[model samples]
Target: MSAGTPERTPTPGQPRRASVPEFGHGMVVGKFYPPHAGHHALIAAAAARCATVTVVVAPSRRESIPLDLRLDWLREVHADTPWVRFVGRYDDHPVDYADPAIWDAHCVVFREAVGPGPVDAVFSSEAYGAELAHRFDAVPVAVDPDRRTVPVSGTAVRADPAGSWRFLSPPVRAWFVRRVVVVGAESTGTTTMAAALAAHYGTSWVPEYGRELTAHKLARLRERSPGASVFDVRWDSDDFRAVVREQQAAEDAAARSSGPLLICDTDARATAVWEERYLGSASPQVRAAARRPALYLLTDDRGVPFDDDGLRDGEHLRSWMTERFRAELAGSGVPVVELTGSHTARLARAVEACDALLAAGWSLADPIATPHTN
Candidate 1:
């Protein structure tokens, strides 16, 4: 009789509830907008009484933070909790917070996603929380520690993140402070690829860190430094260092989240390659920063048809850039998994390589395969 064992019981006009000993497997559903302290307390309480906890992260029409970011927030808070699992709501059917039908659908989806288990209870604070419990044939435990009396909502948090964050747990707050950056040459599909990988892996990504910094620099130059002479960005400038540092910091933060893995399109190594090629020499600090990547992916210049993004500097330049990147990586003695050929082929190859590497005992913390079709 472990503390978290499941319990069972029969109910009138409802699905049979498992006996007390069968309540070990529990399911919790919430927006967890930022997974505040209150949310953590609820989850901890549930964990104490359950062998396993499944968290259902449902999308709120009232909240704007993407589902992926919210998922990241949760992972960061419960990184060490092995018994905890996460699932996002399906986009097709909107679940009505007050509808038992919706809750029934959600429970079915949850069961399918997590597989058959001895779930005997549902932990929630929604208006129909009890109904959901009945529909799922589980005991309902509602804890409204926030005093809001309404659902502990992500919408409320998004309205005033700083103010409402007090409702979130400390772990959620820490996730906000952490950042995840995706970097690569223009038109290298860094942004798209980063988004895709994040979605596939269920993590968060920091938007282009360099673009924001560059925009800020451009704005500052337009204002106080209006007449400042435009210098080639390659010249040693504090601006360049600031951008590099920002990008590096973002990547580091993303890596620390509870998500099983975080994927970055680019790393400090890519930046160093750019600086060395454009500025003639990379700063020692930048060179040192480049070594922080847990794994390096060198995309091959396999004549993948190029699109005119204006920012892309032709295939010839890309070929040269690829060569330089290889040379730099060689000098640093960092092993790189090179991906070449058509994008479709390359992606497939990458998946295979990753599967093989994972099988061989490589750390699953980083990308190890580049899928490329011949």
Candidate 2:
């Protein structure tokens, strides 16, 4: 249900600092491509002075981030303010601040979403704030016109997410976090690489859910039959499905709290390879669960000693598994870096790959251009 502070009326001759609001209804409209801290502060300032505030989170259809996702993040960030309302509409109309026809076309979309009203105040920080307020026949209240308070913008964020990381809320950060997955054959140092990368970056890492599932199976078998071994554990299509679901859920949860980069031990695509090892074929469902990560670090089995961790397969299967992983990942579009040699050397190479990815920065398509006018 839509939630916000209850609508209220200004009391007659009340003190300015009292509970009474300055305006009956206030409106805040913007593209909110990603809704950074500056956007939040503007809405907060409006909510403080108005009895009720309506925020229109409008973005063009060509934008990468879905419109509903933008609205969801804005609502989550402002959930505590019950008097503030957030609505979304696709404003695909061309942006030409000086053109009256373009302004009228855009205002029509905003007005329909805000409902029939007396919008007493139009709160904004854009150059068109004065004209927008005049169209609504409301007072124009500018907040942080010079961008000194928050010191961030959607364009700046889209250009360099890591630099503007602090300006993004948790949900927005989760969407921006770069996921780096480490995958390899048994005893090929996948876990070690993932943990080391997380430590080097001081970020959160997700452990292999498939390993936890394997241990659980072994423990359960031991409970039924005394001294059960890893070999006794059974495999089924459902087991791989569980791994994919749990792995994805864990990665998503970690992304919200992780640093600029998130390290993952093994992802769904690796699980599909493991499924092929045991079942001779990868299930359709398991293959579908594979998602594209920012980068993939495949720890080559060569030169790495096989250490049976009580849950790993025999040493002979390591070479076959490594080859299978290589063949499968070849067609995957994401960048894959094969880590070989000593642990130290592989870690150094992995670090270089991660640094390069972050350095490249994000590439978001430009929004409708508002030509500069003198």
Which number leads on lDDT? 2
lDDT (tens digit, per residue) of candidate 1 on 97-187: 5666765666676666556756688887555668767877789987673435333344444443333434554344434322223333455
**Could you give candidate 2's per-residue lDDT for residues 55-79 as a string of tens digits?**
9987888888898999898888777
**Per-residue lDDT for 42 in model 2?**
86
**Judged by lDDT against the true structure, how good is candidate 2?**
0.85
What TM-score would you give candidate 2 relative to the actual structure?
Answer: 0.90
List, in order, the clash count of every candidate structure.
30, 4
Which residue segments of model 1 deviate by more than 4 Å? 1-185, 215-235, 305-316, 331-333, 360-374
Which ten-residue region of model 2 has the weakest summed lDDT?
A: 1-10
Residue 200 miss distance in model 2 (angstroms): 1.3
Q: How far is 291's C-alpha from truth in model 2 (Å)?
A: 0.7
